[model samples]
Target: MVIDLQNVSFKYENVNVIQEITAHFNPGELVSLVGPNGAGKTTLLKLISGTLKPSSGKIYIYDQQSHNLTNKKRAVWISMVPQNPKLPDEISIPDFVMLGRNPHLGLLQWESKEDFNIARKSMSLTEIDYLSRRKLGEISGGERQRAMLALAITQQSPIMLLDEPTSNLDIYHQIKVMKLIKKIHTLKSGFGVTILAIHDLNIAAQFSDRILLFSNGSIAADGMPKEVLTKNNIDSIYGSEVTIITHPEHGTPVILS
Candidate 1:
């Protein structure tokens, strides 16, 4: 397992956001966390990214206790693209993307040519190289989203976590970004693992190797998309009527409402 959570739970303002959850994520898997609003999906991502410590239980990354790892060390292992991160508006897009290299740089060290090459490659892969010179504040929401993804890619970590990466994108851009992510996961001989908290059920079903359905601070279902995205599971957890079908080309589950 690349990440192991042992009875992990988190509370916010006396409210249990993530309750006694035990889960394990393996390498080379593209896993999606899906559920209705307030289901603690984002909170779970934060816990794994080490941004929010678990109020109870433990999280192990590659068999090392998560809490014992320093912030820099954790960054070297995991990279995250948060739902709504606070970014500096005045920084150029390339500059922001290069910041991802900080975790690997020595203290007071300037970015080297190798770091620049990595950052450039990331921007190209994310399709944001055209906006290199533009300030972050000057970009559109979709553009900013891609820029954030580029930054995370530049980190070159084994594990990547994204929250709503396709939120602001149109259909074309949505598919494009997802395909890019899938391509990246397959690189390095498929050793990378990606976990995303996404609201789009169809997209999740199409791209995810496994689906984790969250409900009321717990996992309602966990399995391959075809197994976990059945009509019964959707009706019970989402409380909505949805039709499940198989994609003609990909043979993956497709959720239609």
Candidate 2:
């Protein structure tokens, strides 16, 4: 799948949340959107996912205009995992995952065997199968996040757009979830990801194949992690004191601020 944005701008009231921003995302890549608070990272994801439209310019997903897609088909092409997953108290993880099959079901159609199989597979892939029978509200924060990921995976979209996916998890599960995402990208040749509004510079640098740093409602830097996460760029955009160093094992990046 491909995502292309050209002169995209969005506004809420008189405030311009995003301004004439242009970007492209390709398949088999994990891209991170990072910036200060209210820098329009999440808003950009919202625009790409069709939750918000550009007030000016255009956004195309795989050459199709976002808003023009039918509702059911939209969920099938690009799935989203929001920061706060609001699962009902009575919804079990298994059944919660079944909701992802909505695009494939008719108005009154029951979930079929294939839907069950896909949901189970997604649960296992997210390492949350053990939480299947548990109520979503009854699970721990990290487990619930994984369950939500399971739901997204069950949607079987080519592109996954996540907004602060690891925000609520502790350090250990944060790494676990990042690794699960990496595994999925590796295992599925055509699958790709875009993460929005993440604050942890080191984690974003470590995981994303590319990084788009936002500043004042526009892209400040866009390139590989090594290029976009440089000390100069970090200082310029974030106004922070940061030292960029290599990771001990992977030699990707390790940031000190």
Candidate 3:
């Protein structure tokens, strides 16, 4: 397993945001976390990224206790594109993307030519290269989202975690971004893991190798999209009736209401 969560739980202001949960993420899997609002999907991503420590239980990344890894070391293993992250408005897009290289740099070391190359390549892959000179504040929400993804891609970590990556995008951009992520996952012949907390059930079903359905701080279902995204599961967890159809081309589940 690339990541192992052993009875992990997290609390915020005395409320259990994430209850005792055990999960494992294997390499080369594109996993999606899906659920209704306040289901603790984002909180779970934060825990896995080491941004928030679990109140109880443990998280192991490649068999190493997560808490024992330094921030830099953790960054080298996992890269995250947080939902609506705070950005430096005045910073150029390229400059912001270069920050992704920090984990690989020595203290007081400036970014090198190779680092710049990697950043450039990531921006190109994310289709944000044209916005290199623009300040982050000058871009649209969708543009900023892509820039954030570019930054995470530049990190070159083995695990990528994205929180609502398509939230700010339009239909076209959403498909574009999702395809880019899928392409990146397979670039190394399925060498890494990409996990995203996404609200779009159809998108999740289309792209994910596995689906983890979260409900009230715990996993309601876990399995292949076809198995976990059934009508019964959706009606129970989401409290809404949704029709499940198979995609003609992809053969993935399509959720309809």
Candidate 4:
């Protein structure tokens, strides 16, 4: 397992936000976390990424406890693209993406030719290579999201966690990003693990190797899309009417409301 959460729980201001969550994520798979707003999905991502420590139990990346890892060590194991990252407005896109290489560099070591190549390739794959000289503050929200993804890809960590990666994108770019994610997963194969927290049910069903359904700060279901994304399960949690049909071409679930 790349990530293992054992009886994990988190609290805020004396209120429990995540409770007794136990799960394991393996490499060579794309996992989607599905839940409504305020369902503790983002909080769970934070815990796994070590942005916040659990109130109880533990999170392990491989055999090491996540909280025990140094910032640099954690960066080597996991790369996370958060929901809203605060980027320096004055930094050029290429310079910002180069920051991903810091985890692999020594103290006082400058970025090398290999580092520049990696960053450039990442930007190209993310379709943001044209914006290399632009300041981060000058881009559209969708473009900024891609920049963040480029930085994460450049990091080349074993585990990738994205929170609403397609949130700011249009339908065209949403599909583009989703396909890009799958492509990355396929190319990386046994060495990489990808996890995403997203709102679009049909997209999640189509792309995920597994789906974790969350409700009221707990996992209501966990399994393949066909098992977890049943009409009853979605309706009970989302409190909305919906129908589930298989895609004619791919045979994955297609949700309609």
Candidate 5:
């Protein structure tokens, strides 16, 4: 599934939030959207998730147009993990993840054995099976992040859209989450694509197959990690002097301030 956007512009109350942006995200790729604070990362996620339609131009998931994709159908195709989610405190992690199955069920349908199996498998994939019985509020921050990823996995969408999936996690959990994302990307099954709006440049470089940097409501740079995360581009968009060196072990771009 190629997410093809052409001159896509989004506005709020006559205020332009995303300017004419054109880009293509290919199938079976992991992409990271990176930028400074208030660079419209969240807004772009909303647009891609079918919450907001572009004011001008077009967005296509495969050959289908964005406006034609209803929320119900879109939810089935793309699962999103938001920056901050308000999970009900009393709900267990497994129960919370089961909610992702709503897209596959009828309005009056009840949870079936298959649903529980899917939810259980998702927990296993995220390595959160031990926390399955724990209340969402009782879990640690990293556990909560993993729980959210479990929910996303259970949704079983071909394309996953995540907003700050690693926010507030410790370094260990951060690496864990990135590795899980990479695992999903390389699945033998036809899980198509994954896109995330992230803040950490180093993780973006390390995990993402491609990086798109936004500035002034447009894509300032788009390419592989090595090609885009240069000293000049970082200084221009982030407005800070920084040096970028290749990581000795991983060969990914490492930025030093």
Candidate 6:
């Protein structure tokens, strides 16, 4: 397993936000966490990324317990694109993306040619290369989201966690970014495990190798998209009526309002 959570539970202000989530994310898998608002999906991602320690139980990244690892060591194993990242307005896009290389560099060392090359390639892969010289303050929200994703890609970690990656993106960029993420997961030398907290069920059903449905701070369902994304499951968890249909091309479940 690339990422493992063993009976993990977390509390904020003495209230449980994540309740005993025991799951393993396998290599080369793209897993989507789906649920309604306040389902703890984002909180779970934070726990896995070691940004938030669990109140109880364990989180392991490639056999090393997250709580025991130093912040730098943890960064070497996981790279995360947060839902609402705080960008430095004065920093140029390329410079911002290059910060991802900090984890691999020695304390006194600067970004090497290889590091810059990796950053450039990540920008290209994310189609943000054209904005390389632009300051973060000049970019649109959607563009900024892509830039953040580019930075995460440049980190070159084995496990990638994204919170609402498609948020703020229009339909075109949403599909584009999702496709790029799918391709990145398929890359043999790149990320081994990709986990995303997403709200768009259709996109999740189409791209995810597996889907985890979260509800009330727990995993309501966990399985392949076809197995977990049924009409009954959606209705039960979301408390809303949605029709489930098959995609014409891929035959995956499509949630229709």
Estimate TM-scores for all models: 0.97, 0.96, 0.97, 0.97, 0.96, 0.97
lDDT of 5 at 99: 91
Give residue 245's error in model 1 in angstroms.
1.9
The lDDT of model 2 is 0.85
Q: Which tens-of-lDDT digit does each residue in 1-257 have in candidate 6?
A: 78889999999998899999999988888899999999999999999988888999998888988899998888888899998878779999999999999899998999989999999999998889899779999998778888987898889888889999999889998998898888887874534889999999999999999999999899999999999999899998888899888999999999999
Which residue pairs show collisions in model 2? Answer: none
Ranking by lDDT: 3, 1, 4, 6, 5, 2
- The digit string of per-residue lDDT tens for model 3 on 138-168 reads 9998889889888988999999999998997
Q: Write the residue-wise lDDT of candidate 1 on 11-64 in tens digits.
A: 999999999999999889999999999999999999999999999999999999
Q: In model 2, which runs have C-alpha deviations exceeding 4 angstroms?
A: 191-196
Single out the weakest 10-residue window by summed lDDT for candidate 6.
Answer: 183-192
Model 4, 1-257: lDDT tens digits are 88999999999998888989999998787999999898888899889999999999999999899988999999988999998778789999999999999899999899999999999999999899999779998998878888888899999998999999988789988898899888877878678999999999889999999999999789999999999999999899999999989999889999899
- The C-alpha stretches of model 6 lying farther than 4 A from their native spots are 189-191
Each prediction's Cα lDDT score?
0.93, 0.85, 0.93, 0.91, 0.88, 0.90
lDDT of 2 by residue, 17-104 (tens): 9999988888788889998989999999899888887899988888988888988888988888888856688888898988989988
Model 3 lDDT on a 0 to 1 scale:
0.93
RMSD of each: 1.1, 1.3, 1.0, 1.1, 1.3, 1.2
* Candidate 3 error regions (>4 Å): none
> Best candidate per lDDT, number?
3
CA displacement after TM-score superposition, residue 172 of candidate 5 (Å): 0.9
TM-score winner between candidates 3 and 6: 3
Error of 4 at 138 (Å): 1.6
lDDT of 2 at 34: 92
Mark the 10 consecutive residues where model 3 has the least summed lDDT: 182-191
| TM-score for candidate 5, residues paired by index | 0.96
Question: Model 3 reaches what TM-score against the true structure?
Answer: 0.97
